[model samples]
Target: MNADNNLYQLYQSIELENVILSYKGEFTSELLTALIHILEAKMEELGTDFRVRKRVFNVIIECFQNLYHHIDFYDFRNEKLEVRKPALIIVKYKDGDFIVNTGNYVMTKDVPKLEKRLSFINTLNKNELRELYLEQLNKGKISSQGNAGLGLIEIARKTKEKLIYNFVKKDSKISFFSLKVVVGN
Candidate 1:
């Protein structure tokens, strides 16, 4: 009875938020693909505008790829495998806009660099962002994980909004990074 009540409450909460879809767990490639398909179907069923749907889909892809590549799998000391690399993603509708919120675990040491990058990106105008994106793309800069490091920039470009983020310390070694992007309809 308690479990059922809790589930009902959760469902009501989701309804209140107008959430279209949500996932919380390991972010694997297979799961990413499945999520993309599901979201596409939902968007279609909702009759979302093509441009809005494209922008939202692009940002979601970038967010998921950021989680896939940058998530820390081991402890800060690089000693043992962390039990779970949990991630959360929620797509919701509010005021004729689609909001995407994604959360993942990151190593504490990387937080500063991530903060700096996001801060810099936030300072740019649309034209400046486009120039930077093209410049980076032309350079073909690739990270150790084979990502070109353009996910953040592309996300910002697609959403045309400043990325809202929070880093909550989970422990001494890890922090949970949450990012929110909004796309206007």
Candidate 2:
């Protein structure tokens, strides 16, 4: 889902009512920084309160980092091969709510596990989410990708909203995961 230069420009140019910040290419440190800066500027222009902005930033950082650390990308050029993992994020800022969508490739076998995690997180109340997050953090153990699923739980708690997800088929072996969270002021 690579974006053309024109579309990217249009996205940057307009003061969108429902702004959708999408990342569909290589997820380098540089790209991630640029996205965060632009999003911050846009939120500032929208007159968002400091608390809301802080929460939004935290969610964005965690979401993007999770994708960056967990995804793998492969490249083949001139009979040489290189691999990299890329993450795609789409953040939509709508009236009274911010919708964050992020996606990354995952092994086919991991689908059920991810789904279960999402389901569990979505069902928790604020107190339960906080308890779960503290529990995970106090344990001080990290996952294979250096994550403890706290990001998802944090998004759920901060938003006080449901987390919606979709799995799109990318190929025989890999799948694209889309997660959307809405935080309302």
Candidate 3:
């Protein structure tokens, strides 16, 4: 399709999906702080309940951190052009519920482990998720980077919904991992 047509198609898709906010670019701490303020203001303007707003904000933080910490930053020097940083965040509202979606690039080798972790989190009920979250928190299994590994569980517990995710192969060595969480008003 032509450039204009492609842009129009993207607009149509976002509208169809009820997207309130969408961003795709590099993730920096400064940018994330600004975005969080913007999101909070938007949610307030939209008359979102405090509880739901809080849940969405927390999930967004977790998703953003996941992108920042776990993303693979392999050099693509062989390519002539700079690849768009494979990071995206979208917030959509429908039927009194909000859905937060995030996408980031990950090493292909990590996909299976991630899929398994998400799958297990998805299978847990609220209490079970809470238990796991606390267990992990108490165990304090810190990574070299100081991550406690409770992000996914906390997202699931707060949203009270199964995490939805998909991994699409971007190349031989990397894949795009997308995750979605929904919060009801």
Score each candidate by Cα lDDT: 0.87, 0.74, 0.83
Q: Which stretches of candidate 3 lie over 4 Å from their true place?
A: 72-84
Indicate the TM-score of model 1. 0.92
Give the per-residue lDDT digits (tens) of candidate 2, residues 83-122.
Answer: 3556677777777577887877776667889899999888
lDDT (Cα) of model 2: 0.74
Best by lDDT: 1
Descending-lDDT candidate ranking:
1, 3, 2
In model 1, what lDDT does residue 73 have? Answer: 35
Residues 121-168 of candidate 1 have per-residue lDDT tens digits of 999988999999999999977876678979999998987579999999
Return model 2's CA RMSD, one decimal.
5.0
**Per-candidate alpha-carbon RMSD to the true structure:** 2.0, 5.0, 3.1
Note the clash tally of each candidate.
0, 4, 0
**What's the C-alpha lDDT at position 124 in model 3?**
91
